[model samples]
Target: MFNIVKKMPKALWIVVLAHGVTDLSAGALLVALPFLKAKFALSYAEVSAIALMQNFTSSVSQPLFGYFSDRSPRPWLMPVGCLLSGVAMVASLLAPHYYLTLLFTAITGLGMAAFHPEAAKTANRLSGKAKGKGVSLFAVGGNGGFAIGSLLLATLLYSNVSTGVLFYILPYALLGIPLIQMTRNLPRPEVKQVGSLKTLRASINWPLLSLLGMVLSRSTVAAGISTFVPLYYVSYLHGSEMYASSLLTVYLATSALGTLFGGAMSDRFGSKRVMLYSILPISILLYLFPIVGDVGAFVVLSCASILLSATFTSSLVLAQKMMPNNVGMASGLTIGLSVGLGAMGVLALGKVADIWGMPVIFTILACLPVVGFVLTLFVEEPEEETVSLVVQVSK
Candidate 1:
């Protein structure tokens, strides 16, 4: 990993940092959810609306932004996205009404949506022959940001939400200046001017659909675990808010390391193989998490997060490879739209928590990795010819 980073271009490193800073809003949003629940006196179902609004908006808009990026690279979106996401998260803190808070969260999602496809495409292009390593490094930044952002905001919340606003603003102001400078110098892509259908016929793109299915499964597990784990610690296990939030931080931090290694593993063993091996163990661990309870639960949950997050970059690189003619759109679909859709699953699971209980949510989560595993079996690896074509087109 150190060798890979050392070899990476400075521009890619900047993109990685930008990716991390951009994701701070998402990390902050997770910590804020519990606070929003208490401040507004919200039900599980109602509190879920905040995540839904943010995730769903990003889901719907990312493909559009991606399509636009494929047609004309817009490095400006990088800084704009960081600024918008950071500003919107701060606005959520100040918004008096729950509805207003939801609106700001949605805007934050849009910022996230705007940033990913273009940044991902840039990373893919700059990755040279080591696309898996490049994409994984990029993904680690986002995962690290999620960990840091949650921890930062959670600490700030010890004082109050007002203090949390400082976290949202200062990081972006610090990071956004460099992000703007770096993105401006990104090389332009030369894509085939094929019609969208001709590029990869959606109707016949079974591999693509399989990839989406795999991503959906992964995201559902991610969304459910990330959203509910803290609540489980607090509501069921009788832990403090700080303790609950810290568990979330542990989960995300472990995931960051997993993502970093997973990418390297995918390059050697293939993305499909890495995903298949990772998901089966993840399923077993997730099933054990809620049953373990207390310290055991923390240990089980952290272990599960490592395996579960290992699949993230594998799926991303596969999607780009599959849709070689439109990597931006592929990134939008895989990272943006699929994740957004997966986050929406949180709303349904939130309803389950309301109806059945939090433990039931974990039971449902355990099944999704199996789904991802089955889809991985169906995702035919891109042909050598396809890989060669992608490299040629990218050049």
Candidate 2:
């Protein structure tokens, strides 16, 4: 494990930092919402509109950028994206009218969409044999950035220093210098037709749809737990909202740790095995969550978060390997589509919560993993030789 960590390239580390910057900007929007609402004299529906618009743009545009990245290999998008994301998000706050703020928010999404697929592709290409580890490191950076973004910006605003919003720009400027130098000499996209759609279609492959099913299932359960569990904990279990928030923080932190380890484990034991092992237990623990005592529920939720997140990098790396010819598209679908669809799933789950109850919502979540497990069973292990062949062709 130590050796694997040591083996990652400097370029991959830069990409990881860039990934952090991207998510930091995206997450800052959440913290800015209440302030924006107050400043604009907005209603709850409008505030929700800001979030929904940002998410919709980011989620939907990623694959479009990703598909283009595979053909064009625009490495400059890395630094450019980081800059655009930070500048636009901060600008949204400073915008005078509500419409301008919303437009900046959408552009911020486009910047994030521009960042992820390219960054993920770079991480995987530079990782050498430690591709899983490399992608996981990239993922962990985003997780950390997201967690810190909310806290950092919220602290600044609460401190009554509105100028602190400008502070978010510093990291991008500092990081962008190195990123520009690093991306300058990246390999141009190869024009070979061997890794093209027709040739690759003839090769043996795992079903991409199966992997999609697995990701959707995982993301749905994850989104549900993150969104609804706090309400459940406070309302049904009688914990303080603050305490529930603290526990939710613990869950996010632990899940990031889970992402780091999951990749290393996948590298050792095959991704298919790791995916199967990581997902099945989550179903059991989630089923037990509502039935447990307070401490037990906390423990169960934490463990479930770990196990659920453990599949993130493994699935991502697997998707890249499965479609080496279209690595950017694979990354886009795995990262962007899952998030977009999962948020949609959360909306559906919200309806469930409204119609049934929180407990019923948990019951539905417990069933999702079982569906994911069945999908995993159908995902034939992606062929390493095919992965190598396509990668070589792409280069």
lDDT of 2 at 72: 58
Candidate 1 has an lDDT of: 0.82
lDDT tens readout by residue for model 2, 52-123: 888888888887777788765778888888899999988998999999999999999899999998899889
Model 2: lDDT of residue 1: 42
lDDT of 2 at 360: 94
Please give the lDDT score at residue 354 for candidate 2.
87
TM-scores of all candidate predictions against the true structure: 0.87, 0.94
lDDT by residue (44-150, candidate 1, tens digit) is 98787887788777778998888888766777888898789888988887789988998899999999999988889889888987888999899988887876887
- The per-model lDDT (C-alpha) reads 0.82, 0.84
What lDDT is reached at residue 126 by model 2?
Answer: 82
Identify the leading candidate in terms of TM-score.
2
Q: On a 0 to 100 scale, what is the lDDT of residue 64 in model 1?
A: 82
